[model samples]
Target: MNDQNRLPDVPLRASICMATYNGAEFVEEQLASILAQLGPDDEIVIVDDASTDDTVARIRQLADPRIRLIEAAANQGYVRSFEQAVRASRGGAIFLADQDDVWIGGRLDAMLEALATQAVVASNFDVLGGGDRPPIPRLRAADSGRHRANLWGIMVGYRAYYGCGMAFRREVLPSFVPVPAYLHESHDLWLAILGNTAGSIRHLDDSTLLRRLHESNATPRGWRSLRVILAARVVLLRLMVEARRRLRAASART
Candidate 1:
């Protein structure tokens, strides 16, 4: 571990914010994979949402000084837990992590390189399932085609951004955090929408993560009910309106 006293008080280069809940089955593996990629200067900020399982114990077993654990008083859902973790991070660039995924080697380097040019970037990832499943499609940004002029439109329409493969610079934090209570989308998508409107969201071609598929995933599996679809549409409309407002404000400043 790097000596903290010798380091400056300013934010570090990379701060990974991971939210975990009852993920003892594979959390250790995920942590080991990520920790191996980080430098002595990098840090991982983990927020556990009151896991009843041995997840906390397993994480503590790592005993790495770079890892900081924050135990939530109560069980907040994934969105809120992630919000807290992000808030607690002290890095100029933030990476999101899921407790069950295995990060590919060089993931941090690739993301940091992208962040040099883009305010927010997401990379491709291979899917992993138990017992040898076929390869899954790579995660990519949607092709806007005629809607290329509107980045937010492409994001809202395709919903392709995955948080596990995403990272963003600290400059975008103001627009990304304190996630709107009314938005029905996940924190990743909301940040993507804002990044797109800011003209700094990008998709890297490299696959830097192994996204594990399992029953414990917080993402909905298949088709959703009509009620869910309608709610999502409403949220999308609201997001679009806000994006437009911000764009106008930015244009005026320019």
Candidate 2:
């Protein structure tokens, strides 16, 4: 069935926000993989950040009416492009997509179901060997110092938020910080931390997204992947401290 003529019974509509740069190498394959998982009511918004390659032409070649392509005159990078895509979305639910990764079938279905009663639902991903080794989920230890790091806690930040498999409701979009200008690479972390304050973020451990580990990947997988893990930890710790200080200040005012 064509997604454009979607029926109304489906309780959810998913807007997939895809950001691209010089990703022509695998962008088509990635788009096809995602297009396959989409239900009748799903929508896709692809933001191209002025790719010097044929990425834009390749996307236009597919010409799927359901896919909306936005070309940036100049490169705004992934962070800004992603934000633009999210704002352009009209779906009741929003899912972020990476330009190079492949989504396992049924990923959206599982995540949407998991997020049914919650504010966000993120799934676990398996790393493909060609790029880098996948990191195991260690929520218990990661949550150690901060009590709010509990799966249900608001201070969990983006450390626990998996960008490849995360989805959120459309109404909450306004609360998100626009993709920051700083060179800090973890935009997902920033959104997740802010999201925690607005609503709940539930973990959907069943869905397995294939995280392709290729040298061309934005943060190519390898031993270096540990840097992202460590950075997330540091960010979470600072957020926790700030949250504590804010709470104390509120108490004093009260």
Candidate 3:
């Protein structure tokens, strides 16, 4: 990483896109963690979803020129907020970030290295902030036994990718952005599905982020009952059908 105040001679290689909403409690720490790994050539683009708290203030306090903040006029959900950040970014590679999670050391370098060969890459992450009892069970593409097959199967079936641990090339943006209004999936999952279909999608066996589990997280974790799981599966199936339809339509246009 280069000095924050200095500019790089080369063009920016990576654009980190983050979406925030009332994330004042951990946004500062997350930003610091990300900043430590970024080079002078990299930039952070944040889209805040009309937060009523000090999330935007905390971000402004950083005062780093590399950090660009965009305040949304109305509170779009997380998916749309992320879409706005990605559209505003100016880098060959785009890394999705969550406002509350702390990134691990060497995350950017590792993901970029992986992205050189694959269209998209997702890394493993350790669950953080959960108490001594037990951490929540999050899926990883590597552990799901479906990476060799269509990677989207694992994503659509198991919901394996987390945005904070994922990165993709700018070329995939055409198919990813303006995320389909009918798909009821998170932005990360949508990207994973599209990236897998567009080119190669792989899982790096490194823990690239500390996934913090807290109450304020946009995607809550209490929906584990049998009926809830079934309903969720139905929703995922519908998303998969719609996603395939969109892919076909895109191919036809191309």
Candidate 4:
């Protein structure tokens, strides 16, 4: 999230927002891992991105009341699919999730604890079955409140802020929702931008989930061309400006 407020008196409801394409093979296991951790007040909001496979059917087969399934008429890609899930969510705490990952035990307790005071929380991850870790270095707890430093890290492409490892309070949604129109990818970094712009994000050192990498992943599996890298950097610069504007507008309203 580049998404929250700190009103402790209000009831706590966690919304796990997930986007799925053709994930029938692993969706059930992922959902089971997450559902086991959710309380009665919590929910799992999933948006299917027009999967031609049995993804939607697998979700419907669950028959869980805590699950809210939204079907897309056509393929809108994962970023907008996630945005739709977030906008449709009713929880005060929003957690971004990927369909192929398994939530580590106590993840909810750990992240919700961070969101209590910070607007956003980004945790670390381990590759499932002891596979190679992500190319970027993991976040350090010592750098939790260093928003400027974190922003620099994100811009330099070493912060490793994957959506599956991030969550935020509801108050910050206005800062990054309706994500930058040109962003056909890297939504996590966009959220990280707004989160750091507001100077309120917690970086957790511990791994909260086990990620499964596959060829069908929405994120590219190989290195991008230098031109693409430079283009993406320009987009990051634009997102930084947009984040500041949104944060200022939100502040004026308050």
Candidate 5:
């Protein structure tokens, strides 16, 4: 262990997975926000996407033994970094975290408890910037039930959108090995949908995170214009096709 680490034994409740790339600017703030929410029982797993900045050095300066920093030999991109970090984790529950977003206190506790039976629990979040936006829509029990009624449409046509608010049981990962690298941005959608095939999966109606909107954000910052909406739909369709193919592949292996 690094001499700077101060955290004791790993917490079994949850593993916070942070995949970073040149996040030195905001990574520390995000880390502090997460650490504040954690009890001594939690653990942090970080994969540096071979950042060309001081991100690794800054992480090193933190003295928490629970903080496991894995520096990739090269830039693996966000999806690979996240997968690698979570796969190496020893925690039972894994919470997906963004390096630049701030998670609200009680977020982990709330998410963990919500997965009591389901293989995953995804909470809602508020998107900031551009305007006074309302909270992101949290999936309700009714939403899950309604979607499952038409599982085919749900799996192949509909998309379940959640990012930093998602958490999964570690065992569900083997189902994702063959996911194409190009489908990285849509990984969360793929995980939740495939999980339902193996076990129960549902979404929580609770709001648990603050998703910051910045230039680096992958999604649009404000209400979508017609052109942007059309472009987004195209991307969404591609994700669904790719994810469906991967899901079929995973099923065949079973």
Candidate 6:
């Protein structure tokens, strides 16, 4: 690329967006793995959700110019944190990362390749310590582009979509962002909904990262009350309706 075509002083190829909250124990390792995959132009955009631990200090210690950290004023949960990171990022490719997971080798290239043709791409992951994957069904490559079916799988609580394994092209930022006011959690599901509704998602069968499961993991570990479960489902249903509306508006403009 020539200087005239470059993106100012830094031409970012990808931005790995991370949301952290008191994740000092494993953040450095995760960042180390991520940094290795990124080019000099690539960056890691982090939104610290008022972490009480040394997560901020550790990140600063790495001192890599590629990292851009944003400290939130108050704890607004992971969904808002991720939305902030995504909005702040300037890369053409945006990746959602957890503070504790390790990116497998080739993950960056694979996701970038998938994103080249699709608006959103979600890959699979294995447990860091060889633990069994969650009981939910894994995403299949053959299911890629099956938008209606995929959204239905999500509504029925069978689809396994996690933020750590998800990324999207920058063009889709408008569709994914400004998260619903009522969505307290499961931002990953919301992204998946938008991607499927647009009919532009790729489901990769390859495991792209090593997810570290622990007590402090962001995902809830216990079963919720029936009422809470039903409430969450209702929120997702609302999101589906919202995604359809957003896509319709976008189409009308074109």
Best prediction by lDDT: 6
RMSD for all candidates, in order, please: 3.8, 6.2, 4.5, 4.6, 4.6, 3.6
Q: Which portions of model 2 miss their true places by more than 4 Å?
A: 1-12, 129-132, 136-147, 150-160, 180-184, 220-254
Write the residue-wise lDDT of candidate 4 on 121-186 in tens digits. 999999889978758889998887788988899888889899999999999887768888999889
| Candidate 5 RMSD computed on C-alpha atoms after optimal superposition onto the true structure | 4.6
Off by over 4 Å in 5: 1-11, 128-138, 149-160, 220-254
Evaluated against the true structure, the overall lDDT of model 5 is 0.70
Query: Where does candidate 5 have its weakest 10-residue lDDT segment?
Result: 1-10
For model 6, residues 50-84, the per-residue Cα lDDT tens digits are 99989989989988878888899999898899999
lDDT of each: 0.78, 0.67, 0.77, 0.89, 0.70, 0.90
Which rank order by lDDT, best down to worst? 6, 4, 1, 3, 5, 2
TM-score of each: 0.86, 0.75, 0.82, 0.94, 0.77, 0.95
Off by over 4 Å in 3: 1-11, 129-159, 224-231, 241-254
Q: Backbone collision count in every prediction?
A: 0, 1, 0, 4, 6, 0
Could you tell which candidate, 2 or 4, scores higher by TM-score?
A: 4
Candidate 1 lDDT tens digits, 1-254: 33333545766889999999999999999999999998877899898999999998898888898888889999978888898889888899999999999999999998898899888887777777535322334445553122244444433445456799899998777666677777534777777777776767667767788888888888765677889877876776677677667657656766
| Comparison by lDDT, 5 against 6, better one | 6
- Which residues of candidate 1, in runs, are more than 4 Å off? 1-9, 129-159, 244-254
Residue pair clashes in candidate 2: 131-213
lDDT of 2 by residue, 1-254 (tens): 12333533433488899889988888888889988988666778888899999998888888876687888889877778888889877789999888888888888778788667776666667665444344544233224334244523433333445576677887556554344445345566555554454346666645457777766766534554667657756665665454345435544665
Clashing pairs for predicted structure model 1, backbone only: none
True lDDT of residue 81, candidate 1: 88
Q: After superposition, how far is residue 181 of candidate 5 from its true place, in Å?
A: 4.0
